[model samples]
Target: MAGDRDWWFDEAAGPLIRPYAMTRGRTRPGAPNLNLVTQIRASRNRSDLSQLTPEHQEIVDLCERPLSVAEIAAYLNIPLVVAKILISDLLELGDVVAGAPFQTSDIVDTKFLQAVLDGIRRI
Candidate 1:
């Protein structure tokens, strides 16, 4: 799957497809940096995103607030995987900024929260 980035499965073989996983050093406290998960997600998000897509625009807009990948994903009603892709793209484009750790808060929107709960019920 070196060249086929989206090839996540081998259907005919009935085996799990493996994508290349690169590793990098973790960020230290009070350091200015990006996490590997964030980088990967952002790259994937930007790969096919267009300016007109609400999801894409939402990501871009949220980055202005320096929201984490998890926060953005939850806010946009998109899968974490999808949010990661968008975040990675924004990071590469310098559209997203990293910041020091801050106070954690539970601030999920009702619409997104309901959608997530609905998905859980279906599953």
Candidate 2:
């Protein structure tokens, strides 16, 4: 008797049976094989970040402080992947600088070294 059609059931089923509800198949872990078809599909769906809106430009500007992609994503409340895309776009447009210049001095501050070690441990 409780199986009767109801508004809640209809609303729930709508999302469950939606075309976009299917899982995106996973890539073989660490495999070097890249499929051309998948590349083409991704290219078709990819957003051109270079042609960004004002909001996206704001996000890019926030990334100029040398934060990691994860940090940038957290600051902007966006996915890390999206942040990476924006960073990549900025890099292409010569709006971002790459890795810090290597210092000739072998001396690194103990606290900075410890922080790097801690980060490595988390990964």
Candidate 3:
């Protein structure tokens, strides 16, 4: 019986809560501009912490140093849509502020990336 139940709650399995449950089944973010490059940061007003779920609070903490929507999703190990929904909730509550998407210069620079890769190879 123990072996039969082991697969159900394996050590490799993640959180018990379904991803949809965290967003209350919301697949889309209320704010439409939350793209992968959009930057998020915690706001000065954190008085509404009690109103936030644990996932939302985690986003707030992660955003303290200004993180991208994609980064937040990666850090939380959740889907991008799920992270966006959580961020949307915090936005509505004034817990976090969203910044403009990361912009790139007209000219591309592959040299910097190549240098870093070479340094890693050397190590």
* Best-matching candidate per lDDT: 3
lDDT of 1 by residue, 1-123 (tens): 122322433536421422112101212212224443332222223434464344455566555445666677566544455555555545556545555444334545778778888999999
Q: Per-residue lDDT for 59-98 in model 2, tens only?
A: 5556545455456556544444444554554555555544
List candidate 3 stretches off by more than 4 Å.
Answer: 1-11, 102-123
- CA-only RMSD, every prediction: 11.3, 13.6, 7.3
C-alpha lDDT of residue 78 in model 1: 44
- How far residue 26's Cα lies from its native spot in candidate 1, in Å, is 23
- Quick one: RMSD of model 3? 7.3
Per-residue C-alpha lDDT of model 3 across residues 26-113, encoded as one tens digit per residue = 8899989999989999999875686777788878988889899999998877889999999998888889999986555532787876
> In angstroms, how far off is 2's CA in candidate 3?
28
Which structure among the candidates has the greatest TM-score? 3
State each model's CA lDDT, in order.
Answer: 0.47, 0.43, 0.83
Q: Evaluate model 2: give its lDDT.
A: 0.43
Question: Please, what is the TM-score per model?
Answer: 0.39, 0.39, 0.72
Order of quality (TM-score): 3, 2, 1
